[model samples]
Target: MPVRPADIDLAQRLADAAGAVIRPYFRRPAGLETKADQSPVTRADREAEEAMRRLLDAERSGDGIIGEEYGEKPGVTGRRWILDPIDGTRSFTAGRAIFGTLIALVEDGWPVLGVIDQPVQRERWLGVAGQPTLFNGGPTRTRACPALRGAIVATTSPHLFAEGDVPHYMALVTAASGGAPRQGPVYGGDCYNYGLLASGHLDIVCESGLKLYDFAALAPVVEGAGGRMCDWNGDPLTADSAGHVLAIGDPARTDEVLEALRGAVDDGIAHDH
Candidate 1:
């Protein structure tokens, strides 16, 4: 079901609160710590998440919360909020403006509303299921690209992919370039890539090994902009979806991209043995 406008407003407030806490730490030397997975975390990530949680607790205490910095907090209501306070921590630490705050509302295990806020750049993209995506106070839609060749796909990095998954990803990259090199899939955007895809700047994005908080907010943003986002097998993304995700700005190209990616799935599966 579609979220009410008031709830969407609250989601915006959550993003704003997170941005306030994160902006001061960006580009500054933060106390960095490594997680068990070896991914870096910083004070910015923690404090920002705390800020959003504080607001959620006071306003919608009955809603569940899942955050990157903190552990999950279940609520009586079936609805939940998923947060990545600073989606591109590396970019923020590097003083780049590509970092964003991701806020999502998932009800009954499906995402229904989302926001991608780039605080440094002062750009915001808001999406509600079954409604037009809004970009900085205006409705936005993605650009159309009917084929993989010259589609301008993006991924955060090949390193994020598993050893067995890299070949499959490269196949799609090759398909995008049609075996020739002329601005193929660009790298290094993180959540910002999805916002760009929604605003008609990027055409496709594929990534693996994402958590619910990592990907939940992106689907509504991409889909609300007249795009389609699904798993590698072209299944609609849900709370239980596998980490592999594909977002295509042009709805017409979803099947083609999925097919190209699937062509190497057998190789990926075999290599995993």
Candidate 2:
């Protein structure tokens, strides 16, 4: 189904609402708490999501909601809104401006619209399927990276990767650097990296252990900006996709990135055998 202009407007409104609730809490003591997973959460995270949810409750009640903070609310419409109020809580706590609010509208499992909002910087990237991505309402495109050797790869952190997934990430990094370490993978940007990639500042971003809310909004932004986002196996992202994600700014480099990851997995399997 085609996304309506009104829906796109609503998405920006959702981002606006969340940003309002988050700004006052940034850099100030916001009553932090740790989730069971040992991840940090603050009042900004909860209230930002709440503010967005309240808007959805009033404007698009029929749309399902999958939020990082309050859990899920199923709706009758085949569409759902996936939200991550703060993609990098640690960064936010550290007073970094890289944290972002992610909003995605998925229809029947496929993301039709996505928004990456950085409240502090007041920068927003909006992407609708089949349309060019927009950064701050201006059309943006990913930069052309001729080869993996020159690609600028990024990830939130190496420690976030599971032990089994580490080798695959390392292999991609090694390949991206052409086997000689010359400025290792850029680390720690969370969703901001995707926005940068959309605006042509980044080349690739690979991550593991992400959740639906973490990545559901990222694919459209990356792809609409002349990039490609997929699983490590090279499949398009869906609601049911595994957490492993690879974002390549240049579409031509997809196979090279996938092969690097595949080679690592293959080597691991051979070693186990």
What lDDT does the true structure give each of the candidates?
Answer: 0.88, 0.91
lDDT of model 1 at residue 57? 96
Model 1: lDDT to the true structure: 0.88
Writing each residue's lDDT as its tens digit, candidate 1 over 86-180 gives 88788888788998999999999999999999998889999899989999989999997967788888999989886577777888888888887
- Model 2 scores a TM of 0.96
Worst 10 residues of 1 by lDDT: 264-273
Point to the candidate with the largest lDDT.
2
TM-scores, each model vs. reference: 0.96, 0.96
Best by TM-score: 2
Query: How many residue pairs clash in model 2?
Result: 0
Give model 1 RMSD, 1 decimal. 2.1
